[model samples]
Target: MQINKDRDWEALYLANDTFWDHGEASPGLVDYL
Candidate 1:
């Protein structure tokens, strides 16, 4: 996983500006977990 320190992107995501949030665990991640 990559981490971004850009404040603009961080703020946007924190403020719900992102378009994708499945509200569930990803299948691949769930499998790994």
Candidate 2:
């Protein structure tokens, strides 16, 4: 099935649902130099 990614992201932002984000990255990721 095809889903509208932009619309879904807008909904999340409008609803203030930020559980998917954190101030820092996970262990496996390295900082951008």
How well does each candidate superpose onto the true structure, as a TM-score?
A: 0.40, 0.33
RMSD (CA, Å), candidate 2 to true, equals: 4.4
Summarize candidate 1's per-residue lDDT along 1-33 as a digit string, tens digits.
245575477677688776557678889999999
* Best of the candidates, TM-score: 1
| TM-score, prediction 2 | 0.33
Highest lDDT model number: 1
**lDDT of candidates 1 onward, in order:** 0.71, 0.65
lDDT (10s digit) by residue, model 2, range 1-33: 245565577777678765667767876676443
lDDT of 2 at 30: 61
Model 2 scores a C-alpha lDDT of: 0.65
- Runs of candidate 1 with Cα error greater than 4 angstroms are 1-17
Which parts of model 2 have CA positions greater than 4 angstroms off? 1-16, 31-33
lDDT of 2 at 33: 31
